[model samples]
Target: MKKIIFIFLLALSFGCSESDSASNDSTGQGGSLAVFALKDNYLYSVDHMKLNVFSLINGEKPVKVNDIPIGFDIETLFAYGDNLFIGSRNGMFIYSISNPENPTKLSSVQHFTACDPVIANSTHSFVTLNSNTTCGNNTNVLQVYDTKDLKNPKLIHSRNLMQPKGIGFYTAKYLLVCDDVLKIFNIENPSEPILVHAIDKNCFDVIIRDNTLFAIGDKGVYRYKMNPNDIKDIQLESETNF
Candidate 1:
C-alpha cells in the first residue's frame, strides 16, 4: 500500500509520465477518494458512495467532514485553489474546502446522468461522464462549465470523447482528457473548444504544466513536450513508461 501511495504521489507531484489512473481494486472500480494539492497542507479524501469527506489534520486518519449522497460512485475529485470539485453520478458538487474541517458544499449541478470525474481552472471546469445506463451508448463526454460564479455554474460546451475515464487541467490553456486516448484541448475560448491533438496509445491519467504533458498509463510514466503546431506528436521527455 505504501509503495502504491508513493508511486501515485510521485506521478502526481512530478512530471513522471502521462498522468492518469486505473482500477486495480477488487470491484474493478476505484475512485479518487482523497487528494491534497502540492500547495496545500491538509489532505482531502472522499467516501465515494456517501460523497463524504475524510479530512486529515496532518497525515492521520481522515476525519469525516461532509456527506454527499450520490447513488453510484463518486469516482474522482480535484482540490483547486479554494474549492473542492467532486464528481459522482449525483452531479458535480462544489464545496469550499478552505476550512478543511468544516467543508461547506456551496453548490450542486446535475448536468449529465453520470458525472464521474472533474478537472478545472479558475474560470472553467471539465467533467467526465461514463455510464452504461442513462449515458447513451456508454459514450464518454467532456462537459465544460463556467465556474466564475460558484453558486451557479453554467454549461459552456459538451463534446463526445472515446473511453474517457479521467481528466486534469493545466496552464489555464489546455484541458487534459485521460482515457484510452489522451487528449489535449486548446480551450483558448471556452465556447469554442478545439481538440488540437490526442495520443491514442496508453494514457489513462494526465497532468500538465504549460507545454509539458505527463501521463500515467499501463506503460508507467510517460512525459512529453507538446508541439504547438502538432499536439499529436510531442517531444518525448524523460519517462519510465516502457
Candidate 2:
C-alpha cells in the first residue's frame, strides 16, 4: 500500500513542467537501485534487457514511446542532463535522451561482472561493484571514471569498499555511498575521492535532495540533515522502521 502511494506521488510530481521540478529530488535523481527516472516529460525505465521510454505529456496517462534492447541484467538507471546512465551486471551503458521519444545509444564502459549501481554528472561517473551479490565475483570496489569523453570513459581511480550500494552527491564536493555504513567522501577532486566520514547506520541506498538525505536499509528508512558547511555534521532527522 505504501509503495503504491509513493508511485502515485511520483506520478503527480512529474506531471509538472521540468522547470518547476527539482532535478535533484528523490523523484529525479534516484538511488542506485532505481529502475526508473523522470526527465522532462518522459520517464525512462529498464527491465532485465530493455530500456522503456514513456511520455508523460498528458500527465494523467503515460504513453509508451519506445522500447530499446539494452544488455541483460540491467539493474539501475540514473539521468544527468540529456544522458541516461545504465548499470548492468557486465557494464555501464550511456544513452543520449536528447530525443526524448527516441533515445540513442552513445557508448558503453565494460567492467567485471558485479552488482552495479551508477551515478554521473558532466565531468565524471561513479560506479559501485558489490562482490557479495550473485552477479559479482571477488571484486568489491568504487570506481571513478573521467567522462570528458563520454564515448570512451577512462577509469582514473578506484578504491576498495565493503559492499557498496547506492551513491549520490550530498554537495558538489561531497559524495555518499552505502555499505557496511553510510560512507561519505570528499570529491573535491573528482578523480581521487578521499574518505571523509562514515555514519554507523547500515544502509543499502540513499536519496539526496539539497541538504536532506533519505537512507534505506534492511531495518527501515532513515532521514538525515546534511550540513553543507560541515562535512561531518550530519544529523539524524527521522526514521521509519519496517
Candidate 3:
C-alpha cells in the first residue's frame, strides 16, 4: 500500500496560497502512496485506524490538534481546497476542512475491497483500486467521480484497469501508473478520458512539475521531459537506481 501515493508537492503545498514556487512545498508522506497531506497551516494524516490532525500555526512546533477515529486499512490521503479525500480498502471518506484544524466528515462512498489511492482536480476525483495486494481482492478498476458537490460525491465513470496504482493530474492531462506501464489521458471532458499515450516503463508513482515527469519504482527514479502534444515525444533525460 506504500506504493499507492504520489503527487506534486508543489501543487499540494500551496493549499491556501496562489504562489507557484516549488521550494515552499514539502511532502509529509514521502512514500509512493501519500498518507499525509498539508493544507494551509494544518496537516492531516491517517494511520491504519485513525485520522491524525496537526497544527502548524506555531511553526516552531507542529502540535497534534485532533485524532479522529476513522477505520481500518487507511491507504491514501489527499487534500483539495477545503476538502480532504481519504481512501480506505472499503470506501472513500470525504471531509470538510473549512476549519483546517478540525475536519468534519461529509460522506463516504463504498466500493469493492482493494488497495485504493485517490487524486483530484477541480471538477473530478480519480480513484484506482488494485488487486493482488494484502487487501485480498482481484478487482482492478478506475473510478471517476463528480466533485462539484463536496457533500455528495457521484460516480460519473468507471473503467476496468490493469493493476492501476498511483494517479495524478498534470493540468487537464491525467497520468495513471499501472504496473510497469504509464498511461496518459486528456481529461478535458471529465466523464470521458481520451487516451493520449502509453509508455512502456517501470513506474509506480509520478510527479510532474516544470514540464518534467519524475517516476519512481522498485528500480529507482526516472526523469522525463513531458511533451503535451505527443506523449511519445517525451524524452527520458536521466535514470538513477538506488
Candidate 4:
C-alpha cells in the first residue's frame, strides 16, 4: 500500500513543472484510493465526511477556501472535466466544480455499504465495490452507471468479480479493472463491458500514462508497454518489488 501511494505521488509530480505552476492550471491523475485531485487552479480533497477545497493560485502556498459536508466514509476522489466523483462506503457523490472555489452538490446514488472506489468520464461512471475488507456487506461487483444526466444517474450494468479494486481507462474504448487478476475490458458499448484480456497479476490498483501501464499489487509494482492496436501485444517493461 505504501509503495502504491509512493508511485501515485511520483506520477503526480512527473508532468508538473515550473511552467505548470506558473500557469496554475495543471491537472494530475491518481489511483483508485486517491483522496485528492487537482483541477484548474484549485485542489479538491475529501475526508471521511467532508469535502475540502484549497486554492493553489499562489502555487507554493495552498489556501483553504471552503469546506462542505459530504457523506460518511468517503474513500476516493476522481475529477473529470468540471465534475468531481466521490466514492464513499455508502454510495457515490457527484459535485460540479464549475465554480472552482465553491463546488455545488449535483446528485448522489446510494449502494450497499462496502469499500467503494469510483471513476468517470463524460458518458458513464464506474465503481468497484469490494466486500473482502471490513467495509461491510457480502457484495463484490463492478457497477456501471449511465451518467448522461448528472442529476440522475442510472445503473446500467453490474458484473461480479472476485475482489475488484482499482479501475482505469487504457483508452477511450478499453478499460482496465483490477480484480483477482488485471482484467482489461472493451467498453465499446458503455452499458456492457466485454472482458478482452486478463493479466495474471494480483493488482490492487493501476495507473495509465500514455502507452505505459503501471500496476501495483501484492507481489510488486509492474510496468507494461501498452499496444493500442492489439491488447494482447501488451509487454512487460519492468517490475519492482517492495
How many clashing residue pairs appear in each of the predictions shown?
17, 0, 4, 0
For model 1, where is the 10-residue window of minimal lDDT?
A: 22-31
Q: What tens digits encode model 4's per-residue C-alpha lDDT throughout 1-242?
A: 68665665556534542122122345665776778888868888899899999998999998999999997898898888788999999999999999988899999999999999998877999999999667899889999999999999999999999889999887788889999889999998988899999998888888877788888877688999988899989899999886
TM-score of each: 0.73, 0.90, 0.86, 0.92
lDDT of 1 by residue, 194-219 (tens): 87777765655666555766666655
| lDDT of predicted model 3 | 0.73
Instruction: Pick out the ten consecutive residues of candidate 4 with the lowest summed lDDT.
Output: 16-25
Candidate 2 lDDT, 104-175, residue by residue in tens = 998998888999999886799999998864875987899999997888889999899888888888767888
As for candidate 2, its clashing pairs are none
Candidate 2 global lDDT: 0.82
Give the clashing pairs for model 3. 4-33, 5-32, 5-33, 5-34
Clashes by residue pair, model 4: none
Q: Score candidate 2 by TM-score against the native.
A: 0.90
Q: What's the CA RMSD for each of the models?
A: 7.0, 3.1, 4.1, 3.3
Considering TM-score, which of the candidate structures 1 and 4 is the better prediction for this target? 4
Best by TM-score: 4
lDDT of 2 at 226: 81
Best candidate according to lDDT: 4
* C-alpha lDDT (0 to 100) for residue 7 of candidate 2: 55
List runs of model 1 lying over 4 Å from the truth. Answer: 1-6, 14-39, 50-72, 111-115, 132-137, 227-233, 239-242
Worst 10 residues of 3 by lDDT: 14-23
